[model samples]
Target: MKKWKAVLTALLATGMLTGCLGNGGGSTLNSESSRIYVTEEGTFQTATVESYVQQDYYNGDELKTFLEEAVSQYNGANGQNQVTLDSCTLDNGTAKMMFHYASPDALIGFTTQYEDKENQVESIAVDKLSEVYGQSESEGVTFIKADGKKADQKAVSKRGESQTVVVTSANPVTIQTQGRILFVSDNVVIKDSHTVQTTKGKSYIIFK
Candidate 1:
């Protein structure tokens, strides 16, 4: 198999990591080494995996340790509701750490406090999926036709957004003035300035 590199995004980072790296640095949780290295600008804190010795393989132990460290650091530094690691999972060298925080503002505060320490946990999941799948497919962004004639009509995703519509007619199609044509099968034709262009002019345009 190919050598794979999994990148775990840090939804939480301790003040120590941020102090050194700035707020964009990351913490590396290594399963094989049973250790976590918190990196900031260019410095890091090397800690033994002692804090997570009893947890499962999915880096739950390491995640808990990180969260504890982060919360402690945040509380001591800012005296606020610190972030918590809600869940964790490890696959293909990537560690996924989910966290629960008060709000985006709180999240930003946490990030600012430990920014040199990294990206959110969602990116780790993204990396894992990217590694497992190798490639990705995306349907291009669609611009809605909200102001056109069919204002009330919604745009349905029929296959990819890049597809085009093809319209064909079997009979003498009538394009009415109001952009709508009612084809009366010889039953009724309430014509009030709504003209129907026919291929052949017939007397009894039998619109019963």
Candidate 2:
């Protein structure tokens, strides 16, 4: 009787451990599956898998073809929406491409398809706005404006998106729309009165 009880207890413990591990694995998988979207004004947005198609590029030829097609489609769709491939260069093994467009919206739509894994977790300074889409990091990214400079900026990440944006000064910062839980650290201030204050220095904001 004693031996049977001990065996039963051991089995129950093993089952509980397995259950906990399974739950942990599922949570991590869900987090990794989240996607980040960059807006026309160079802000990050996050969404679930159901929102957008996942982008993939196997090789250089594939990327080039995609870009060419995007430009062609944009030009054909609207007479005023013209996109030009300003420059293309290969540095070491990485390729750098510059595009010129008449409209910011058109430029964003054309480049959205290529905003995939390649641009994950990439950081860019606000001074170099041209390079924003190319180097966006998946887990998180930061944008900094030079100290004492005024900034009118916005970032839109998908709902439930987790990332970090570090501003050099909180004076010029503003939160327009929010589906994100922002944890502000030292020297950051919330200029928006509507933002809900969670702690002394922390706040939370949610958009539809």
Q: RMSD, each candidate, Å?
A: 25.9, 20.0
Candidate 1 weakest ten by summed lDDT: 120-129
Model 2, poorest ten-residue lDDT window?
19-28
Residue-by-residue lDDT tens digits, candidate 2, 1-208: 3342243234333432111001111111111222222222334432211111122322445445544665677678765446665433322333334455554344345434333222122221111222332233342333222231222235323322343332222112222223222333223333232121122222222222
Whole-model Cα lDDT per candidate? Answer: 0.28, 0.32
Candidate 2 residue-wise lDDT at 134:
27
TM-score top scorer: 1
TM-score of each: 0.29, 0.28
- lDDT per residue, candidate 1, 1-208, as tens digits? 0111111122223322221111111223222221112111211122221111122343545555655676678767765655554445544533444444544344445644544233211111101212321122131212222122221112222212221211112222121122122121122122322222222221111110
In candidate 2, which residue ranges exceed 4 Å CA deviation? 1-66, 116-145, 148-208
Position 158, candidate 2: lDDT: 31
- How much RMSD separates candidate 2 from the native structure? 20.0
